[model samples]
Target: MLLLFVHSKAQTVTGRIVDSEKQSVVMATIALQTLDSINICATTADADGRFVLTADSIPLPFRLIVSSIGYETVMPECASYAVGDVVLATKTNVLGDVVVKSKRPILNVQGDRIVADASSIIKGRIVTCAFDVAKYVPGILCKNDNELSLAGTMSTTVLVNGKVWNGGSVLEYLKTLPAEKVSKVELLYNASPDMHVTGAVINVVLKDNKGRELTGQVKSSYYNNHHNTFQESGSLFYTTPKWSLYSMYTFADAKSISRSQYLSHHTVGNQVYDIDVDARTHSSSLTHAVYTNATYNVSDKSNVSLSYNASFSPKSDTKGRTTNSYFSNSNYTTSGNSYMHNLHLAYVLKQLRLDANYMSYSNDGTQDMNYEKYENPTAYSYWRKQTSDRFNFSADWGFPLWKTARFSLGATYAYSKTGNRQK
Candidate 1:
């Protein structure tokens, strides 16, 4: 009698993970285990949610478990060489996992985004607004008074309550927004296509407050060097179930002194010539701006919003002096003013915006020069006037394709005309 011994060959299993909407779920953890609770193999899904795992020779009926952030877990039982798709539902709400008196982690990693618990992290800290709390966030830098960057990238957009913040300058608005109103802050490094923005963004989720309420803030700053700079601002908001209104005003008075030096060396026809010059400028300006916005909720799915913004620089004056080593010393002065206005309207996810801008500039000044090399003095005076009118119109609309995705299209038109005279 002849007896033959055969061994079973191990088989490979491949599958793809996706969300309920059939979108690929990347960075998901997939594990295979034996029926008796023995670990066999484990792997992670690639960008396309494809994974491959090998079954052992014993083939004891294994099961697969797939899990990802912000999604429900999936478990499928199979034998050998099970290849197909695994679907996961979104984790919108969990009743069994609720703990009312528990503290959330300061940092949580969601796919391509970091959710920070600003309320919990800023506890016991002197944070009056989000700007004050930004310094504590990881991988974020406040480069200047009005600039914020994520890691190394400088371009960043800010959103409040899941909607784009159309308020004035981000730095100015942040100063007036109360920190306590923030529930969480999401840092999105890899934004979705619907976001439109190409760089990192910060999304601030505000608390869900019902009923009517009023909130506002005031801010002022002063700086003194050779000249003095002053800034004052105020913001106010009133909210109700049907309508809400927000307004902000700012005033700035600034004076500055600048100095520059220039040097050049050139050769012409076997002759070398060198020139050195030093220049100094003194400037002062006054600016006033007002921004107001209002929204009326027509229904749960739609709303109407209107916004108006106006800015004016009453006076801007500049005085400059230049001293040249080989020629003359020149002095001059100039002054001008400018104004702008913008009006915006939106219906739900569609917006129509218009802007009317005007500027009137007049420079009545004199240039006096002393030619040191020639021992001669000369003077000249001139008057110049200029005015400009510009108008711009734009319309944008967004179509919701998925729960978290959208298709956006827009159009814009701008026109400007100017008139000038010189003497």
Candidate 2:
């Protein structure tokens, strides 16, 4: 039978841990256990490899265990007050197949989902928004300025900090969200019921700012090709412990010229005819867009958010002329103006979310064509006007069911109306 003897006088055990090369092992774990293998005291080495642990009662012949990352565990010969330095050996990697490690891993796996640390990659770069950082995440593709595909498959919906982003198109929403405000990007392969997602999902997690603070960005660019193009954009955000506000705006003007040729051959009743045509088109467009969102944290487990978005293509005009080999010379002109507006609201309580969204779109345009053939002239004119409205509402709930499985349930409703007129 083994018995520990207790001493009346309290004592302090102090020591330093290091590697074989005498380099201090910072943050190495040390433990003192009784003979029966019960942990009595524990501490960690500081930056200089020093540690001090005090015991109210002494246990004779105590067992000491020391361990550090990337090193083999060490069992000291003694655990008395006069115990000397503990040295550990660096663990060698002899497996020749492959090895992967990172001081700070860019991607972390969390059952059914992968999280990419956006803040780490966004630093020291000109990444102003989430769109600028998505390129670095594997399996995500930027199909265009308006769509994002996953694993080369269908486009997926996007969420900001666990809430669906319905303010505008996916591309536009990503551009408005500041990259610095993002903590991580989660790729949810299996969405939960409360998420209300059909397939895969990409969720952008935002950093929690505790105090009142403001952040913003402004950028512009110009390009010269056959025609000149220019763009300007900006974003602003203000956050407090209870609420957050965000707004973003973009304006662009672009002009271009394109040329094309067509050739055709026809044979009728032993007669053959060949025709060739060439055409040139000049087009110009102007666009303006803005999005704003406000969120209120009702409690630690619940929140509410409201968002609005507006976009306008005030001027979109095209004029072109075609030359014919044997038929007629033709000229055509087209112009259109369009605008879209959206409003969204959401209430989240832990695993449950309720959302409502409304959207409207309107377009007005005209087209005219003029052609002449063999001293005969023909002219055609057409006009078009269209409008659409959409409404959606949903309620979702998600929760863990088992160790490796989750249960999700949701309900959704949608309605839309459209009107068109042409002359």
lDDT measured at residue 187 in model 1 versus the true structure, 0 to 100: 70
Best by lDDT: 2
Instruction: Give TM-scores for every candidate, taking all chains together and pairing residue i with residue i.
Output: 0.58, 0.70
lDDT (Cα, tens digit) per residue for candidate 1, span 302-417 = 67777776777778888888888877888777777766666666566333222222222332333333334456676666666666565544555666677634666766566777
lDDT of 2 by residue, 1-423 (tens): 999997676678888888898988776656565655544555567788887766676577776767554566665646467666888787666668865321222554454566677876575567778877764454455664546654422447777767665434667667777787878887664465567666667788888768898988887888775899998988899999999999989998999998999999989889988989999999999999899889999998898999998999999999999999989999999999999999999999998889999999999999999998768999999999999999999988888888656878889999999999999
Cα lDDT of all candidates, in order? 0.66, 0.76
Model 1: CA > 4 A from native: 1-105, 108-113, 158-168, 189-198, 203-209, 260-277, 349-423
**Residue 12 lDDT in model 2?**
81
Residue 162 accuracy (lDDT) in model 1: 41
Cα deviation at 190, candidate 2, in Å, is 5.7
Per-residue lDDT of 244 in model 2: 93
